[model samples]
Target chain A: MTGESLHLESVAGLVRGLAERRFSSEAVTRHFLDRIARLDARLNSIVTVTAETALDQAREADGRIARGQPRPLEGVPLLHKDIFCTQGVRTACGSRMLDNFVSPYDATVVSRLRAAGAVMLGKANMDEFAMGSSNETSFYGPVRNPWDTERVPGGSSGGSAAAVAARLTPAATGTDTGGSIRQPAALCGITGLKPTYGRVSRWGMIAFASSLDQAGPMAVSAEDCAHLLRAMAGFDERDSTSMNRPVPDYVAALEAPVDGLRVGLPREWFGEGLDAGVAEVVESAVAVLRELGAEVREVSLPHVGLSVPAYYVVAPAEASSNLARYDGVRFGYRCKDPRDLHDLYVRSRSEGFGAEVKRRILIGTYALSAGYYDAYYRKAQQIRRLIREDFLRAFETVDVLAGPTSPTPAFRIGERTRDPVSMYLSDVNTIAANLAGLPALSMPAGFTAGLPVGLQLVGRDFDEGRLLGVAHRFQQATDWHRRVPPGFE
Target chain B: MSLSDEQVSAIAELARLSVPRDALRGLAQELSAILDFVAQMNAVDTSGVEPMAHPQDVPQRLRPDEVTETIDRARYQAVAPAVSHGLYLVPRVIE
Candidate 1:
């Protein structure tokens, strides 16, 4: 196939093209560079573009081919979520606090991807410190949905999601603390996976909620994501939370049929705020699975409704502790008038953090405080157990859980910005997966009012391999993932 | 879940934030609404439930307690707002 055709090809096709030497890695890299130049200005989706580095890596990949060496991702170009720390490149994390900060070390995921020979296409923008569910909190500004510029692309991994959705990059890394990856992927109309917590290393990723943070793949289709994740995931000594379990060969079951597999739909997800269109799309997605030899059943995750609240308290509590280091004393934002260490700490953090971040931090601090610990924080933890139990029990009767990724499709930018509660609630269904520490994915279901809606499939812990298998099969049966945003093209 | 204005103000202080009085109403209302949603946990009976902090049952990976190397004073100071004699400079706390 020609270079133009390859640009829009799935990551599996890109890897195959590189393997056959049909077109040099440099040619594929340049084609995407040209596309980014043409379209990124309008969407502002990609914050830091690494054209020179990408070309350099492409040449090295071609050199390896000259020597008759081959690797699965030898020439694949991938973008990274700005949250991960790259040794030299600016990893913005969508915050002014670290706007100019350059990390001296690469996160385990970055190093692993590089070792896999994936070409770096620079870092994508995200919610500053990976804090917000919407990209608006980013100091770099909001990433517009590729489907419609007026709508949000979702966040805190908005840039990664947009980059994958618009075909600016084949695959990108995204961290989900409380639905960051899944929500954004759902909004952007791509397949995004959040491996069970600790399944992926968090070594140099700027911490959000340490307990909840997980990095995984965002791509046009599940098969592509499987390849991308295979390259980036594994246990690392540097991350205390990194799981030591074997990284399963995810591609083994890409074509596996799910005959009589039971899928549970949580009652909490379909309640109140779910827009008719999004609910319709997700319900039809369940039907598609039913037709493909799966059984759909309604299930109750009684405590699932409390996930967002538990998450708001728990994530912020962890974030507050993790981010305490950025007090203008070491790295990141510092105030101009710092006269002493205390002033520096107070001003640096107050100035550096955005409103939503401050709000969450407040909630977290209160939850963890002396008199309120049992009332807020400990109680939330107890509720967290019930959410996990709900999922665990449901899994005994179901192969997987299904739901709409968000209550609504991509909403107009300013519409939800004025209401933070609405924005936080947008992550409702997806948070339970994080709380349960289960692998969850968001894949395109269908469109509503011309914008794409996402369907989330959550599986038991360490079952991402099966989740991808299910998603790949679903993608084979559908064409929604192939639809591109009109203006973006 | 109905966080009062005083509660929001108190929490902000604990988190070391500087919020103006006028903004307290909005923050309180929003925080209250969010807390209301989170309060859904109160309806469930979780007496025997054990709270899980991480998804995996795998034990936390730990580094040996041994020191890796000497600290890089210069690099550490690079991001500091003000460092004097390998120390961060700060405002005077003296009376």
Candidate 2:
């Protein structure tokens, strides 16, 4: 196969290509690495390109194929978001604190993918410590949107989204605390899924918010995401919160018909704050689902408006506690000199964390502090229950909720950096799903003013198969997912 | 609801993070804005609502009292900034 065709192939296509011996794993891996070398400078999507290690893994996969011992993902090259700990490789998590900290072990997601024979093509950049809405917070640099270089790629999975959108890699792993995976996938015109809170093990993935974080796949199509999710999700004893349920074959579930499916459009999602262009695109996508014999209706989720505010409080409160481990003690960064442990702790953290991270830590500390805990932290948790209840009420009547994934398409870089509240609102539509711990995904709907728009589908907890099946059917009806970025082609 | 610079300093101290004197003013303004934004939650009455911590209501799973694996102290400490005699080195506390 030509290099152009090689880069354009989906994860499933690449798997088949390797199995059929149409292209060797080494050739495929080399093709992607070469693309990153030539194109990534424009996007700043990758933090590290593990060329040597990837070639080694690809060669091993080829040997296995030669011996008729092929594995599930056998030789498919993919990038992991820097948040996942890659054994013996620098897993920076887009922060200066861990820039020098090479992980001693692989994250559960990483280990599972490796077990499935997927080749790692280095780590993708992200918002520092997975905190920001745009990729601008990365200690490395911002990951630019492939569609327009001046615009931002929604983050903290921005790098993974950009990499997959540009075809630099066939697939990449992304973790969503509050819309990290789906928001970026929306802005960058790719497919991303955030499984139910406990669906994927978070044993080695760095904690942003313990209750909210989930790792999922970002790829060009839902079919590809299904193939990757089958390899990535399952119960693990290490993560106490990991759900003990049988892993469903997501790929096989994609064949289920969307006929007679119930899709609800939350009235709150279509109200103010949703860009008109994005709403129109989402409505058109819903029309396609309706034509496929699915039932569509407007559902009320009144409490969802408070999701952003509640999320801001709850996530930061958890983050402050989780990040306290970064003091100048064990691993990570340390200050040059210190008068005492107090100075060491303060100075090391002040120096290591970025502005956005520090702001969150302060907010979290104040919220969880002695006198204000009930007003902020506890109040947010109560509001969280209300938000979850709203979704539960909606799900009682509908199998899935469909809407616009992001409020707008990719905004210009530095657009909302000065106003932190504005930045927080970018996640308004997607945060409720995380709060509810439901399965949700974003797929390319169409383009608006030369930029791509995404249609989001959310489902009841552990109903990822239904969400993927719905998205797969949509992609079949439209060519939006197949549309590559301008210069990327 | 706006936080003063002094309050910001107190919160920073509580979090064990040092903020430069110049950055404190701007930081205080940002924090105050965020607080005002989140204060919108107070408008609704959550009189009997239980605070949800975990998304799923699952009881903590207890494991048998057995060592899962041997400790690799050296391998774990390899990433530490300072280590001496198999222990992590820190500023002298008692001194």
Candidate 3:
């Protein structure tokens, strides 16, 4: 098969191609590595391109296939968002603090995928420490949207989304603390799943918010996502919070009919702050779901608006605690000559962390500080429970909730940088899922003004199979997910 | 909701991040904007609601204390910015 042939193949397609000897895993891995080297500079989507490791892994996969003992993802190449610790690779987490920090161990997600025979093409760029919505916060630099180079790709999974959208890799792993996965997937016109919190292991996934962080798959279609999720999600003893529930056959459930499926349209999602174009696209996508025999109704999630505020409080509070481990004492960036531990801690952190990360750490410190913990942190936690309860009540009458994944399509980079709150609002529609600890997916719904829009479908906890099935059915009836970016093709 | 420069500096100090004199003013502005936004939570009467720690209320599982990990002190120290004889190096706390 030609190198271009690798672009159109799904995870399953690539696996089957390897099994059929249509192409060696080495060939497939090289094809993607070449694509990343050739195309990634234009998008700044890749931080590292591991050609040597990829080829070695691919060759191992080919040997396994030759022995008639193929693993599920044998020969499929993928990009991991730099947030996941890759054993020997520079898992920078898009921050200068860990710029030279080669991880000593693999994140569970990374090891699981490797065990399933997926080849790692290298790490994708992201918002520094998974803090931004626009991917512009990266210490390396912002990742440009594949559709329009001048525009931002939604982030902190922006690199993963753009890599998959541009077909640089067949699938990629992304972690969503808030909307990092789904928002980027929406903006980049790809499929991304943020499995129910605890559905995937957090061990070795650098934490931004312990309660909200979840690793999931970003791919071209829900079917591709399902295949990847099957390998990525499961119980891990390493992550104490990792759910022990049996992993469902997500791939087999992809073709399940959506007939009689209840899709609740949150009234709050369609209100003000939603771009008219995105809303129209989402409306038509809902129509397609309706056409496919799913019932749609407007449901009220009264506390949905509070998700942003509550998330700001909760995520930063957790971030402050999680990031404390990065002081000059252990690993990561350190300061020059220090007078004492005080100077070492302060200078190392202030100099090493980017502006956005510092802002969050400060916010978190303030929120969790002695006098303000109850008014800010505790209040936010109560609000989180309310948000979760709102979703539970909504789910009583609907199997999934549907909305526009982001308020708008990819905005121009630097548009919201002046106002951090504006940047925070980009996640308005996507944060509730994290707050509720529910499985949610964003898929290409349609394009607006030549840019792609995404429809977000959220499901009950551990109900990722049902969500994937719904999205797969939508992809079957619509060509949105198949549409490639202009020059990417 | 507004954070004074002194307050911003205090927060930065607590977070162990050195705030440059000029950056402090800007940090104060940004922090105030964020705090004011989240202050909307104060309006809601969470009178009886318990502050949630974990999303799922499941208690953390405990296992019999056993050695599950082998120490790779050298490998772990490789990434450290400064390390000494089987220990992480840090600025001297005592003269």
Question: Which candidate should be chosen as best, given DockQ against the real structure?
Answer: 2
Docking class of 1: medium
Where model 3 places Cα greater than 4 Å from the true spot, the runs are none
* lDDT per residue (tens digit) for residues A278-312 in model 2: 98888899999999999999999989999999999
In angstroms, the error of model 2 at A245 is: 0.1
How does candidate 3 fare on TM-score? 0.99
List clashing residue pairs in candidate 2.
none
Q: Candidates 1 and 3: which is better by lDDT?
A: 3
TM-scores for all candidates: the values are 0.95, 0.99, 0.99
**Candidate 3 global lDDT:** 0.91
lDDT of 1 by residue, A282-373 (tens): 88888999999998899998778788878877887887777667777667788887766666777888888888888788777867878877
Q: Docking quality tier of candidate 3? A: high
lDDT of 2 at A160: 99
- Writing each residue's lDDT as its tens digit, candidate 3 over A111-188 gives 999999999999999999999999999999999999999999999999999999999999999999889999999999
lDDT score at residue A406, model 1, on the 0-100 scale: 91
Q: Would you list the clashing residue pairs of candidate 1?
A: A339-B90, A339-B91, A340-B90, A340-B91, A341-B90
- Per-residue error at A120 for model 2, in Å? 0.3
